[model samples]
Target chain A: MLRTQQLEYTYPGNKTITFPDIQCEKGSQWLLLGQSGTGKTTLLHLLGGIRKPQKGKVYVADQELNTLSSTALDQFRGKNIGIVFQQSYFVQALTVGENLQLAQTLAGHSADSDRIKDLLSRLNIGNKIHDRTNRLSQGEQQRVAIARALVNSPGLILADEPTSALDDENCKEVIDLLETQAKEEGATLVIVTHDSRLKAFFDHKIILQ
Target chain B: MNPLTLSWKNQKDRPLQMLLTLLLFGLGVGLIALLISLNTQLDEKFKNNLAGIDLVIGAKGSPLQMILSSMYHIDAPTGNISINEVKPFLNPKHPLIKLAVPLSLGDSYKTFRIIGTTHEYVDSIFRGTVASGKRWEDLYEVTIGANVANKTNLKIGDQFHSSHGFTDDGINTHDHGDGFKVVGILNKTNTVLDQLILTNTQSVWAVHDHEAEEKQAPAEAVAADDHDHDQDHASEAAGQEDHAGHDHSGHDHADHEGHDHDTHDHADHQAAGPVMKPLIEYPDKDITTLLILYRNRTSYQTLSMPRNINENTDLQAASPAIEMNRLFSMMGVGTDALRNLALIIVIVSGLSIFISLFSSLKDRKYELALMRVMGASRSYLFFLIILEGLLFAILGYLLGLLLSHGGMALLSGYLEEAYQYEFSGWRFFKEELWLLGGSLGIGFVAALIPAFQAYRTDISETLTTY
Candidate 1:
């Protein structure tokens, strides 16, 4: 479960950048759609505990993120929030397995080998787990990023343009995977994207202008 | 990569920088180790060899110079004395008297000093019998030093003419009438004993026999002239007849002059038996300087002895223990300064490492955000950057140590040959080790900033940057 109240925030730079209020409960699929420079990313960052709002409170599973110490915030964020970036960047030195292992370590948990293998195999990247990251294709790398996000079975999953580089077929497949995983884990799923094509897949929507 | 693995990869990325850093550190570490090692070794040698029969009797001079020459076989000798002058203290039962070993310095065969003493020289100071070959059997017999044997390849039965003094140039040759035969080779004492050419007391006197003989020759000429009249000049007339006989034969004409001189010396030898020869008299030469070993060992002072001698004089008093300490402590300033310089360099290097990794982290903010989106934590990201810097520092330290020893090893051989002081192996001082640890600490501290920076990234801003 995740929620944000009144969530007022400024960019903390010279000019103020503010986020609209927001909340999400357990097992919900919410599409965060917004025009460019409409505080979508700023709100997403605040929600992930990366930026303290300077104005509002964010809660995940009823724990206030804004109140946590920087160190505590890091641990809590790593354990509870899963984010998919527009570009999935893996540690170049590590093999795919180590990338996932590091993710679990950051979350203060150990990797679930069987479950991770199961996810990779489902994504058709099972054999690539031991390979160096530079060897992976973009589609396969994105799948690994997804697997790493879900390694610790976090309470919430978030994606930024989760399928920006895929064809319609691959895009459909990635979205299905994220939705199915969130449902199976009973976790909240939130996606920030400009593509209205994925709008049908979500049960709720937050549109900002 | 695991942190170490990732850090190690940096060397591959900048091999030249890594190598340069290693070389610099190695030189610094190596020099320090070598100096300490030599000091330790010298201390051991001094402690071991300087045991036993207390006093060193030599000519009056700088007592320190006297001890150095007579005791350590180094430095110029104080002076020389007649063996007969030291006879008063030769008694084994005299009060305040213990067994004494006399040393006379002068002469060398190829830089190895020739010290004229009895077997007591080995018995007292060196404390061991010759490892190979027999002890000196004749006045002309010489003992090769351990280092001499190793370097010169001289074995028993080898003969070499000793120079008159400690100079290597063969300008002053000892005219001992008979050249010295190598009778023994001593074991490595690792002390100045390793550089001495030891021989009997007779050898010292015999080596200088030319001077005594020169003085005797003129007197003998006068005595021959006087003795001819006492024998009613018959022998002289017969000698004239012999000279005339040689001329008549003509075959012995060139030898006639030589025969006349031989006959003269033979007559003189027959007339004067023991009275003409110089002999050891112990106290009579007045031990120019006494190296006194006291029971209390509390101080260096002893009753001043007579300074004048029949043939010996220069020596100065010195205590090796106190002098050596003073010598080493004088280097404290240089050592402190060098240590400080090394520490500063290490700190600067650490700062460089921190700056390099920290900047790289900032540039990769989006990459880090993506990893977080893929489930990597701020701590994991933080550790990666910090570990890179820490690894760089550790590697640089190791390289410095190796460089130092390798360089020292190369230089040590040249130093020993040129300076006669051997260089040492890897030997870091206690304070030096602390400096090394401090360097690593600086590296770790420098890395902390970047690691913390990585921890506080705005996931959304960073993710969008991608």
Candidate 2:
């Protein structure tokens, strides 16, 4: 469901970072391990179509990310690729249900409240659907973020340090939730992290120096 | 989900800042709208009462006061002038004069001026028709104006005594003679005539004539007591006191005969109608002013008549149009200052909107980036900011209109009580629509820079940084 070849990026100061080839089949999970300054977040942004790489291409669901216009790329990312950032960020003014509805609408689809309710219940955050995102607990917010990423049933899920701030027990639980949800949706999951605790959970790994 | 809904949600997030912006803009718009309505209504009232009279001839004084008193009945008349002095112009055969209506003042019944004039003043000048009863014909018979009838409740055959001055203070009243009877009620002309009590010039003369006779009797008795003194001193002192008392009432029974002779000669030379008879036959009688119309207003003689009257005659002549324009310009200074202050307020409110939006945008950058990552385009954020500004403008404009009309209604009640002049607040002016357009322009311009910043939000940088 996702492929990238020779992805390269440069910082403003002309510091260049290169990536190895990545190919993950549909419904498979992969781990991209990197320490700080290895451009792990940059790779996740490139693969999710949030940023364009200087010299390479990213393909998700047989469509190249660089070939789409800016507007079309934003739509495609919303419909096909979901990214979970290091922090649980949300539109603070909206409630949980409304935020999910906004995501569905911004992707040029009509709102599906039943699907949103179903996803939130499966993530164990059904009671938080009417609550503001700011009022939720940290663990509850993490679950809500996961639910939001899968709200549109995207084919690719990119997670950047999703469990770095959690304790070992919570970290295990969060990873279990991500993997289980991705399996249920038949989406390819890629986790970019420096945490050593998640090393034994995935079979395929890409280590960045 | 939509730009408008998002904009509203963002505005609701900071209620105090939004309310402050709306209040400032509303106050600015309200003041300007009040001035516009006041100016429009004042202009309408002034022009409606001007009534085609070319020049006002009165005793020499402030020409504007003369126009206000005689044409508008809002001020005291410039002292009185003898009717004989303007009799030549009053002749219907005069080369330039179209019509001359005499107005004798100096009496009132319950704060309404008793205007002593001929039927020509009512028929030709005001084109007044009686709504009930008939017009005044004989001495001591009077016709009440619409507002006079309404305020005083003086119906037909109601008798009321005249007071000495323009106001009814209960002292200096004419109590010796029988009260003047209300013979007619005039239809509302929406002019100065709507607030007056109309009668022939003789009724005003006769009301003061009784006081004249009583003073003369006391003076004769005092003169008899002074006969024991030097004859010259006694005669001179008596004459001075007597003349002081009879200054406005100088006519006697012999003067009436001479006035009749003059009227006969005037009638023989001009076409005679029932309107042609002099309401007061005494030649030495005084009138407050003469409202004159020209046969051909653009003629050289007509144009020069005011200059001729001002320079050569003892009377003062002022054109109603000229004096009214002078009045407007004099009032314009204060209105112009207020209008400038309102504009400054509007500009300051625009700046306030800009600052509020700019400052709030700093904290919302992360939220905006989240929206971008959720598939919102750059233009979506841009339009959302613009829509917030427009919402403020539209709401403020409506609030301003409501405030201005409400204030005007309150002020109109006071003005009607004080001046007896009608000022309506329910009327709308066309200039208010332009005010709406100007307010929207302010909103759009105020939002321009902030919207551009929102459009240029870098999602990758904002997301990772915040």
Q: What is each predicted model's overall lDDT from 0 to 1?
A: 0.63, 0.82
Location of the lowest summed lDDT over 10 successive residues in candidate 2 chain A: A136-145
Q: After superposition, how far is residue B37 of candidate 2 from its true place, in Å?
A: 1.4
Model 1: what is its DockQ? 0.29
Q: What is the TM-score of chain B alone in each candidate?
A: 0.70, 0.83
Which stretch of 10 consecutive residues in model 1 chain B shows the poorest summed lDDT? B242-251
Per-residue lDDT over B311-335 for candidate 2, one digit per residue giving the tens place of the 0 to 100 score: 9998899999999999999999999
lDDT of 1 by residue, B1-111 (tens): 245665565344456655555454444444444445445555665555456535565554454455555665555555554345455444445444455565665557877
Best by DockQ: 2
Worst 10 residues of 2 chain B by lDDT: B228-237
lDDT of 1 at A46: 76
Provide the TM-score for each candidate, comma-separated.
0.70, 0.84
